[model samples]
Structures are given as structure tokens and as C-alpha cells.
Target: MLSENKLWYQNSRMEETKALLLQARQEGFRSIRLNLFPAAVAEGGVDAIDAWYQSLRVLVTYGNSVGLHMIIDLHESNRCGVDASECRRLTTDFWSRTAGMFSDTRFDVSYELLNEPKGEMVSQWGALYPQLIKLVRSKDRHHSIIVGGKGYSTIWDLPPADPDQERIIYTFHYYNPMSFTHQGADWLKAHPSLAERRNIGWGSYADRTRLAIDFRSVDGWRSRNDAPLFLGEFGVFKRAPAEDRVVWLSSVARMSEERGITWCLFDYEGGFGVEGLLPAIQKGARRQP
Candidate 1:
């Protein structure tokens, strides 16, 4: 989304991205998961898609060389009514095109079919997932795929894995009790009541307790399904108190590692990121091989 200037995909940003990747590697991070807003499958269609693919390939190739696994997360999907045939067609077609195109991507590359699916998309995931999985597996079998359930990939109501599907990883995003995370945002203050809260910070015993209980559900689901868990995204808003954001992220990182889950924070250059956050997480990590 930041690539919306007159230049679009500016070279300075690309260099900054590389620097961030190298920084993450220097910390204890093993992989990078990037959100994609559009694909060649939309708007300009094939030619557009091919151009996007080639541009991303350059980054992927460099990431592979540097030992950072890349997760290409399709963060947007057709979120229309279940009865709307157009929605399903749009999503299915996008994945079909995507999976076929990246069938031979390097081992370090993976795919996340959709991002934080909500509305009809989440409600009908069972019906939608199999179709997309079939299409992806039909075209590409080399890399792993990450799948998420309803409620914006929260622990609640996560769909279980079908039998014999071993390669798919389960994912969730955590910003639980958004009160503390998104505090003071004017956008969230559109309503009178929500605007009253001020300077909310993380680190209460109640906060820790709630987070543990929520994550325990994910732990249970993973045990039952035997699917690897990926904490694909988690972070407080940039507006949150720096101390609270750092500590909250560190706590979450520690919790994920204790359960053998892999995680990637919300962003590097974004608001949620603090200069010392990655290093802090790394310091506490088990450094699991």
C-alpha cells in the first residue's frame, strides 16, 4: 500500500526492504511474510500479473540467497455474499493463476492463500478451502501453504485440518483486546464512547491471563490436528506506548516459541515496529533449530 506514489515501487523503498531483511536475519528471525494487496490476476490481468511476478521474483531470489524464507501472503480476497457467484469466481481464479505461476518457486518460498478472511469468506471457508487447495496442489507441490480460519484468523472457531493433509500450516493474527493496541487512533474515535479511552497500555495481570487463555485454544487445536502453527502477524499500533508495545510483543514472541510456533511481527517499517523490538525478541528466543 505504501507503493502508491508517482514513482510507484520506488528504488529507495526496495533498498530499505533489503536492509530490513538483513536486519531481521541478524536478529533471530528465520522468515519474512509479506502482505500483497493486488495481483496480476486482477485489473490488467495476465500481463499485469506477469510483471508483478517478475518484480517479486527478484526479491525472492535475493531473499533465498540470504537465507530468509519468504511467505507470499494474499491478504485480500473477494468478500462478497455466499450466494454471490462472482466472489467465488474471483478468488478461485486468482489462486489458480497464482499457484500455477509459482509452482517452481524455491524451497524457501511459501504461499498464504488469503489474509484474515472475514464475512462470507470465513463463513464458507470449508467450502472454499478445498477448492483452492485442490487448485494449488494440482499446479504446485513443491512448497508449503498456510491456511487460516474465520474471525480474522483468531483462535476462536478455527477450522480443523482434513485427514492426510500434512503440508498445510495453520495461522492466526493476534491483536487481542484491541483497546490497548489501537488506543488513541482518531479513526477508531468516530463514535463518541470509543473516543473516551486514553493512553491504554499493556502489562496487566488480567491482560496476560486473557492472552494465555486465548492462545491455549490454538495450542489445543494444533495438538488435535497435528498441523504446524504460524503466528503470521502480531503487533500493537504505532500509537501505543513504546514500552508497552515492546514488552507485549516480547511476551507474545516468548509464548509462541515455548509452544514451538513460528511467528512474524506485523511489520518492519510500519508503526508497530520499535527499533529494539526484533533484537529483544531474539534475546528471549530459544534459538530453536
Candidate 2:
């Protein structure tokens, strides 16, 4: 599960976080990906980041106590693509200072370098990650590093994983047939046609076949490259037909597990909140032996 709550450093946050973690554990979730903002962390300077670090330590420690693994995700990328030199500096700077937090080996946490590389950085990420890997390895050799290709890391856009890289997991986001998944997203409202589109039905034979074909492609990539795959994000917007959302979510989740891909839902408590679809998610999680 992915928690995008921005109140991690705010008052009463721990109580809320504690409740969330407990609920997740009871619900059969094995991990929680904490979506963090790099710009916010950087803007806060040392004091701000120090406080955030303390909160993170609390979450990681408490989460692991309950058998839940944690994934620290840097959830922003807009500022990085402004310029080549600026991108390198900012990307390296963030990891340089933050990677040490994951060095303690005792914590069950992994580092996701960035959310979704776009624009020039998409092409540049392939080159940039090696440096980031080297930087993180310098500080922490115990945790896994998550990386994904550009174009929002969609399955079709995913690049071949490198067999030479150790301790790295290749990731991809899925919201295929966007018309069905993002029907009423506020951000997409600027495109009136898409924004107004609703009630898009799923579960047709073509729909299931398309998903199978796409995941099969990824399975092939994983085999040929000897890489681990993670379905970093996938969900239907809340505004969609509730029944359709359940079906879509269940289908994706089931297919992912069937093919041995580790998956994470898009969010918790946000637009794609999993609260309403827990049944579907749990049902899909039943891995076939």
C-alpha cells in the first residue's frame, strides 16, 4: 500500500500514522510506501529535515515491529527537469544528504530514488541512477534501491532492467486504458472531454486479455534481464463506477500476483483511496501456488 499523507511532520501525525499502520497490518498489507516530497524537505533546511527524519525513524521502527516493511519514496520530479546541470545537482544533493537515513541496516526500509522521471530526465534517468546508486551504496549497503524509467514509468515505457546492477528493483506504474481509470480526475479536468468522461466500463474479454498481454511482456523482460519487478502504482479513480473500480482493481492485483510481481496500490486516503475497495484488493492478493 502507498500512503500519500503529507501530514507526517504535523501535530497529531503520529496518532494518525499509528492508526494507519495498525489497520494496514490487520488488513494483510506487508508494506507501506511513504510518499515524501523532496522540495518540501529541502526547503525546510536542516531543522525541518531533522524533524522529518525523526518522524520517519519512528514510522520505520514501529512499522517493522508489526512485520510491515517500509519504502521511502521521493515523490516529486518537476524541479529536477529544469536543466541538466541543475537536475544533477538537485538529484545528487537530495540523495547525498538523505541516503544515510537508510544506512542503519536494522530498519526494514528501502529507498525509492524518485517518483516518476519525465521530460529530459526520463532519458537522463538511466545515466543518473548509477551515480545515485553509488552515492547510496557509499552510505548504506543493506537496503534495496528502487528505480523506474521515464514517461511516468508506465509498463509500455519501461526500459530493460540491467542485470549488472545489484540490489536494484525495476518498477512501473499502471493505469492502462486511462479513459477508464482516470475518468474524473480533477487534474485532468482541463481536458473537458476526458474529465467529463465517466461510467467507463471494464471486464470485457479484451480488457482482461490486454492486461495479461502487458504483464506477460513485463514478465519476459524480467526473465531476460534477471530483474525483480514491482507494480509501483495502479488504481482507479474514486469517481468511477464503484463496481467497475472493484473489478479493475481486482483484475490488476490478481494478474500481478499470478505473474510473481510485487505490487503496491496507488494510494490510501487520497483520490484512489483503497478504503472502499479493500475486498477487491484482498481477493486479488490470493496468490496461486
- Tell me each candidate's RMSD, in Å, in order: 3.7, 2.3
How would you encode candidate 2's per-residue C-alpha lDDT over 1-289 as one tens digit per residue?
Answer: 6564567666577878877888877777889888876566657788876777778778778889898999988776766665656678876776777678668878888888877887668778888878888998888888899988775888866777767778899888999888899987768744666678878898898988898888887877766777788999998888888878888888888887777788998787678888646766666546312
**Residues 1-289, model 1: lDDT tens digits:** 1111221234556666666667767765677776665532347766665666655666666666788888877766534334336556766776776677667755577888777666666567678777878888988888788888764787775678877875898888888877877666566644444345577887788888888888888778977886788888787777777777777887788789888888888876565654456776555444422
Lowest summed lDDT across 10 adjacent residues in model 2 is found at 280-289
**Per-candidate TM vs. native?**
0.84, 0.91
Give the runs in model 2 whose Cα sits over 4 Å from its true position: 189-192, 284-289
- TM-score: which candidate is best? 2
Give lDDT: candidate 2, residue 186.
62
Model 1 RMSD vs true structure: 3.7
lDDT of each: 0.70, 0.79
